[model samples]
Target: MTTEERDQLRRALSVYVEGAPTAPEWQDWNFQRAVPDRQHRFVTGPVVALVAAASLVLVVLGGITLLLRGNIPEVVGEPVTTMTVAPSVTATTEMSLPTGPVNPAAYADVPSFQGTVRYFQHDPALGSPGWQATVSVRFAEPMRFMYTVVEERPGDDDFLFLGGAGTTFIGDGTQIWLDEADDLPPLQTQQPGFFRHLFYDSESPSPAWNEICGASPERIGVETIAGRHTSHIACSTTLEDYELWIDEESGVVLKMRGPLFVGDLHPQVDRDGGFEFTEFAIAGVSIPEVKIPQVEIAGFFPPFHMVQEIDFGGGSVDTVEYWYRDESTWRESIIASSAPSAVGSFQLVADGQVGQCILEEDLCSVVPLEGDRLLFGLQLPSPTSRVPLEFVGDHCDQLAEETILGRAAFHFACDGVRFEIRGTWVALTDPTVGRSDYWYDKGTGLAVKYTGEGWSWDTQLLELEPVFDDAIFVHQEVEEQASEPWPDTYVAADGIVPAWSGPLLDGTTLDLDDFRTLPGSEPGSGGSFVVVYDWFPTCGPICLDGITDFQKLYDKYGTTDWSVTGGPNIEFVSVVDDDVSVAQRTNERLGITVPTVACFADEIDPAKGHNGLCTPDSPWSFWSIGVPSWTVIDTDGFLVYGVTGRDYDFAELDSLLADISGLTES
Candidate 1:
């Protein structure tokens, strides 16, 4: 098909899967046809092995015979050690109830309400396969619980399942097992673990928890649910501010709120706001086990445009919700918005830290500035197209507000923790198109809330805590090396390619077999100085600048003993489109025509992919402007010089070029 027709087809598909795939045209078949890699990584990992072991322990305790079964006492009566890195919390030695009347009736029938759990998650980031939301947990008799994650968002034609049960811990008289299956990598698993250790522990020193879920031994007022009264306890933590309803008589937890992504992503806008359970059942039934696909989040959205719908074409689309500590709620409106640029540099921060920031976006650091104003770097998106957006700051403010489901919200004020500032985000399209609310408390600045159509997660401000030893709140840019200008210190050789091979950029080509080095035995090696110029056809300014620089370098150093060559522009042409071999041939035909420096300009082999031996430090540094380029060979055919773009040193080039020429420094 013609490129124009192909472009049109791609655009049509992009628009078709914007909402619930209620249409037959976009079915499972189409979903399978779309997503990049269909394989699921969670079901086949070392982590899953732990889950299986947990199940085996439970079975052995009950005297069940299985190949993987363990000793009954070791599985049940024996202590199951749990190693955790938790925050320090100071507590009184005595366990006293809160200053309130005991509501005995509130704790009834809590133990009987235990059963399997099932749920789904939706994300606004349409690119992710929806596996984070939908969750199902099956509690073993007294407390063993096995949970499975089935299906993800973006609606895949087929569902991936993760098979496993949760760990067991003894609480009061009943054994308890909480399903924690969201440990899949590429999903920010570490962040969740950080939360678990900080708040859940009563020994945690962080006072945030007490503010949300009132401390134990202290009785809180009672609340009625489903014709039964229950004791309500509220607490908050830096990671997750939560509340728990306990059956006063059974001490069983009937309902809970605030076990979600916290920190900047979930600022405590309203600690008073929380989630309420609508229903409860105590039954064991097998829900379909689903393996969740591992998703890697590359970058963040620009500070504009509220996302409306994320089209996960098939069943891959799963759970979607907003996790924010806000009292104003969310509303819908017809707002024009612009999409952020997609071309971005990919870098890995440490092992788990992965970031992809635009080259032009402003990045500020925490280092003190000499002046009142702070200087920062900007990472602008690539020269690609951006989504159009009309900024509307106050459009449908009242109508667009809605309460997020299943999210726990909290608010806080501490001595060291303070908010720097908060502001209304206005998209570029219109000064008043969309409004974004940010919260900052103490050492960690603004706690930002992130939510897309069907996906949502809160980035804890403290999770990515800044280390001032180097710099904080500053731009993290990878510095590139710079090499000397080319050609002035380099030279191109003619008859570089075999005459029988074909035509070169400079037109004429002759057999290089006749050439000899100073030692006489090495062909084209004795007394010959060779340099390789690197250039890319698609690298616009950078490539052009490199070739021009190399040409000039050769002019100043050109001599009977010096020769240079560079691969035809075809090597630099984007391989995404044309065939490599065809492009290579075409590049040789046009390499010399575009630009180059040669000893015998008419005898150079343009058909040869490269002008000469790819030299590293012969003036042109490929590492700086392009990938890796420039390899210089001496009279003995030994590589004597090499350099990569941006990182090349001019002094080093001078030394290498002199060495290749067999000339001593003046």
Candidate 2:
């Protein structure tokens, strides 16, 4: 039969089978009782046999339908009756049930409890030494109250200094705003608040279950925590391994110990040493009233006044004074100073203009704020109540409940970002480069403690007092003088490249003069052109492709006998900002035979390292934001062409080479 006819037949058979009376219904039929005993037996016996045969036919037909639909994989010489229907059903059953020693469902219903949670990390390499935050959370019905006092331990501080105070909600309920504190403008996007149900309802599996659970969760026996008996569950993922201790009777998570994932691109978290949470105690719910400061400004009351100390790296510190006049309109004054001297000061009136002044130079400038410069130092972005859980949902795995900083939290890994459930606070470390950690109050979402890689600031929570003084937003009056425009410090394209020397992979020191000179002429030759490639060993595929392209160019011009004798020889060299070992590995991987130089002996020190003709002050910095930069120095040692990032435009390079070679030939 045709496929359509077979489908129609299958549908008709299904309808007939569904409409047929069951054995019990058949027995209850009036006709069977009405008939004489001898005749009834004869009739019922054949009818029952026919019914059973028809049911068998329906089952066979259903199997055939599934096979035609490709739901069942076809096999040669295999009876259709032997094939199992819905193979996924078996696979799912395997995944959900424990093949190992632990029954995860046993401890799934953790009783709801409220308490304070403290989570902290210490790494001497991070410079700040150690940082931690403690927040009080009350786990109850309509809303969970979260309140925390922000504190910071600066490089000079022997003890934690009070930074600020704020509050947050952990459930689907209206915020209890203090009569004195006015609500700030809502963020552009609604942030996902902490779900208290995750703690109270243990039946709902944690987000990281599949990732951490693996084939099965192993029960590590019972342990006492916070004076309660708890069942320990051991779990692991490809990233890190951790343990979760759930209360034996209550099922509430008591503690969790694991390493946090760090970095966005090249993620590296300390595997051996990680963050730990303990001393979880049940505490009474008490949310202190938060007072918002009111600042008087131009017939309007600015309800927020924030004093932030920002370390702009490189030993420069900027003390920023912020006064929010509504949402869009605000005033920011940044007093930047380095060790031994005050570098400069800038006051940004985000509504219209920006005024800047250099202290020692007696230089001042006022520029119109527009486009990209409009938000210059006004650190106002739509505030988030908590980190957006959806953004990291796909990367999240192996979730376990634990008490952090005295509050119930679900510890999980998202991509490389680790979460120790509390407020929307994040401590990020890019071990590939540097580390930056910030603590924001769950309620206010204001940063309390901030420690950057090079420059760091720890803000102690001062009193949240009213700003009666309007003069705080007003610019200080200086001696009346015309403002001078700020001069650009970066080198422009076509600027002369400063001479520098570094040893190449071939064990020969090459300087800019070496490339500037013609093949058989003196150093002042005006026809030679140099190509310097600036790249990093860890720059991935694009860098390798660029290296291959450069190698081809070198083979075509540098190695060609006629090309060298015919015109000015083009010189090609690569300067990598990595160790010799890394450079060597990359060279071997890419099959690169070109002369490569390691800028630093052991590490990537941008200040002291020789990265081609490109330095921190080079205009190339504007284009080469990340790696794989290329610079072409003309015969006169002037930068003729400079481009950042990998370019697949071999035709452009070829055309430039042809034009330069033509000039030499002429």
Candidate 3:
């Protein structure tokens, strides 16, 4: 590459390593409206205020940056492009359930109780009177109970969340309706909220709940919870059963135990499962004026985009009010999404605009929709939050298949991104969450909505709007015979990079300086690792014992800048048998390719002897493993650190690297 081209590539790599740019001031307020009933608020006691203050403080806390550096084998090139291979479909079992006998009484008696619970409270810290939430439950033919909660503090806003006392319900119910939509904030598409944060119906709760409930009733028995005598029962259809406590003499229900919110996306509260009955008085059925808005009643954002304009009723007129959120802030711009593309492979168009408005004049009076009010649809991620495609490294692995509700799912980790795909349910180590099931269409390569407790949203693929030049999308196939790997022909742009050079059990030279620089290394920079092996050639008990412990460490942190290499050390072609010279090794290892490997040794000469370059030299610190123990020089070519003999503290090695990386950062 020319000097200018090389510099440009270097700069690009540096920018990527530094991460995406800090967002500019956000002005994209598509929708903002005041609640009609401002007086209707929930009771937030001092405890709530304290919790809110803590959350706010935690968000503002800053963190320290640590610079880490490492090197992989020469075979793997820099800026690794990871490919996620979906697992092959497994054969369907002829008989779905294993032949084990079903327990005689596997199902539990699940009570269908309907009632709204209310509460009143006061907080000293907020100096405000508490709020109230009134919930009405209907079980059989409108037979129900209504709960009303009142907070009587001195001074404060009295607005309660849905899950708060007064209106909270425990039965399985569909959430994500227009009533609660208006209160939410606009959600960023790519960074969707965690599944636990969303709502789920009570019937099908989280997978973890299934595992706990699936245990025999004996395993989930009666216990005194919160000083209340209670009995635990498992429901056959739902993840949560029933915890019922009654008035011993009257036989009337006293307290109820189950999931508070009835949504697939509700976050789990393991300990807070049962509700104690306070004062229950009989009153005429009353419909508390519950003003369910179209947006999130509480502040919540949806994953969507919006566009708006202020004036211009005619063609080519003036007065445009364009706004968009770049992840954090709303931004105002003269240009609109309808305008031509400026950069990247994709342009995020709001779901509201696509297939709706055509000309700028048509969109002139378009008012921006409130983010919280947007239901799931064809929403695009805000432009600023879209991450550019980049590769992870070689320590990727395919996890086992997870099956749920007769649909199977697969999970794997490659580079750094975790790939989870749902298919036909199969048995998994853990019970599957109802919402985690994402069906990907084979033909279209897009996600189909997975079944939730009671409702399902179609996560269908929108149009593949082209953002890149046609040429960029075109793929090329390389002829195997024509494609030779690195270190075989060319060298890194910065020239010779010295690495590990030692003797294999076969007396062959072992040099591994060729792999791509561990994720973030500048040109001309390098690192080291010790490749220890148990067997001379083949596998046996000795080999197993020698490698087992080291393998454990590698698994915890695979291919880190500092790691202990595994596998038989015979992969490297020895110089004696192959007649591969040191210069040849250098050429083969330091070439342009995907994940290449290099070496510190030059050649294998039986007569002239192994290349002397393997020893300590300038810019490289040499190290020893044992008598026959050998390692390459450090970046500076000096011999400074070494674990000689059979003694080595694995913890010390990790700490040393951590210290070095810390110093570099400092």
Candidate 4:
């Protein structure tokens, strides 16, 4: 190979093979902390967020969004006053279930209130210091609220994000409307109301709702909270116990204490933390007009082209190429397969227009950017810490300036910040909210460095000149190979199989009923495992990598360890559809001693690209969904798991292997 070819090969080898961040380090990918996905492209590389392809946006929150969750419709408006919940507070202490049901929905349409509240979350047993905050809050009719954080106290954790503190956020259901302020965070102008997540079905909601709630509050009594006559109620659930002090007249909850969880996403966890009103009263809230923070990015922005290198700590690395044409236009491309041409790729880029598509299988989704919600779609991330600092509600602590990669960069850090993805709610933030140290290039305001737990990456400036080509800012069309994956044909087994047969390379016809089973499994599910590797060397470097891996795996055959305490059962098979002769030749060439199977194009079935293991009349198709795919089957002809990617999901495969190992342990 020429030097150029060798360089390309080396880059493709190092760049595209490992996409996810390593475990216990950058393992909690920041995807969950962002909005849900529109059309997520399965990445085959590292935590490098690339948007050159139209699939998913790797938001600063951690990972990509694969699923979406809609907000629960609020039962507000009209101020329904049919609430007749008059409970006699005869019992002064803890008691059993109350005869009078204390329904929270009954108070849902009650008078709105405004007051100062205090809340906290802590669990010494959870092995980390917790958080506490004090904020003044006000809500007027449907979707008008002014939430101002008075204080944020995070204990013992440098990465502790005091969410939305120090800034009075005014929202009329969506977008930040904070008044004009100098040097404040940018207007997280899109989907700003995501902080108010509704996780329960309203009609019969969980008693844990922070709104006019529902759910059975186990016990009822009377107490005064915030100087209001209240019915102090307590609840008991399988997880923990909680209490609430509701207004006797209005049905509004005056105070509440319980385990903190919003439809399952709970952070600073393992303990119940709650908030209560120090003072509250019925009042009409006046919505204020707040201005988006103006970040100083004139000379600092348009930092041009740069490449970010992410070290996965396991001798593997990936790079994120940035093409920042200007402030409003930029692209993040993580060359999953190969770059410059960007095949087998996943990236983020969009035209200045609103949108184009939202199909999950499509390579691109131009999610509508209504206003200035650039970061919402994994657009260009600003060099200013204001945006992230606002998300975490931290007062930007300007750290000492640092030199990174021979460039002077502004240094700052946030405990954590949840990036917003509008209308997509697969999951919430908190899974990967680690202390993140950020460094911005002083001259360009480009994020030069981002370091978190156990892992770190650097953005080295390649060029600082303006990208003159307007075509570079234009989004690329979806390619055939880079689109969504092939349909998953793997199915669960029912512990039974037909007497189907296929030709093995040893000139033997192996029937489903002919294999031996593991010791503890059912008698005749065609017993021994047929670990099938679905690839041949003709499939390029991907297939070559698979063949090499298959060789290592095939080595386990006939060994004491392979038998797992000497049961003498599991089998390994390599499937090649080229031809029986081709299979033999490839196997010999690759030194693949494992028994090979020839699944040549069957005349009975229409020709397809990959006609794997020709059990033509069998229920288990066992076909290669994608070249370099692999599947596991029991002695029975049933699919245990199937991985259809350029690279195997080794962690998932390891888990399946362990499960089988446990089954054969006896």
Worst 10 residues of 2 by lDDT: 40-49
Better of 2 and 4 by lDDT: 4
TM-score of each: 0.22, 0.34, 0.25, 0.42
Kindly list the per-residue Cα lDDT of model 3 for residues 149-216, writing each as its tens digit. Answer: 22111112322333332212211121111111112211111111112111111122232233333434
lDDT of 2 by residue, 1-666 (tens): 122223333332221001211111101101111112211000000000111211111211111111110011111231111211111112222222223443333323332345444433333333333334343345434343442322222222222211212323323233322110112210111112232222313333222443455545666556555455555666654323456665435434555544332111000112222222233433333333322212111122324566556565544455655555543344544433332122334343443554444432334555564343222211222212123333233334535544323334343343333321111222222234443344433333344444444445544222233553666445454442222111111224434666567778777887766656556666446556887777764344566677778888777665543344455667778877665655665677567877787755544354654444344454433333235667677777766666555443677786787666643433
Q: Which lDDT tens digits does candidate 4 get at residues 439-555? A: 776675666676776557777555787555666556556554423232233242343333345678788776656565645777543356667776644334567777677667556
Using TM-score as the measure, which candidate wins? 4
Measured with C-alpha atoms, the lDDT of residue 206 in candidate 2 is: 27
Ranking by lDDT: 4, 2, 1, 3
Instruction: List per-prediction Cα lDDT, in the order shown.
Output: 0.27, 0.40, 0.25, 0.45
Model 3: C-alpha RMSD to truth?
A: 28.0
Between candidates 1 and 4, name the one with more favorable TM-score.
Answer: 4
Candidate 2 lDDT for residue 638 = 66
Top model number, lDDT: 4
Ranking by TM-score: 4, 2, 3, 1
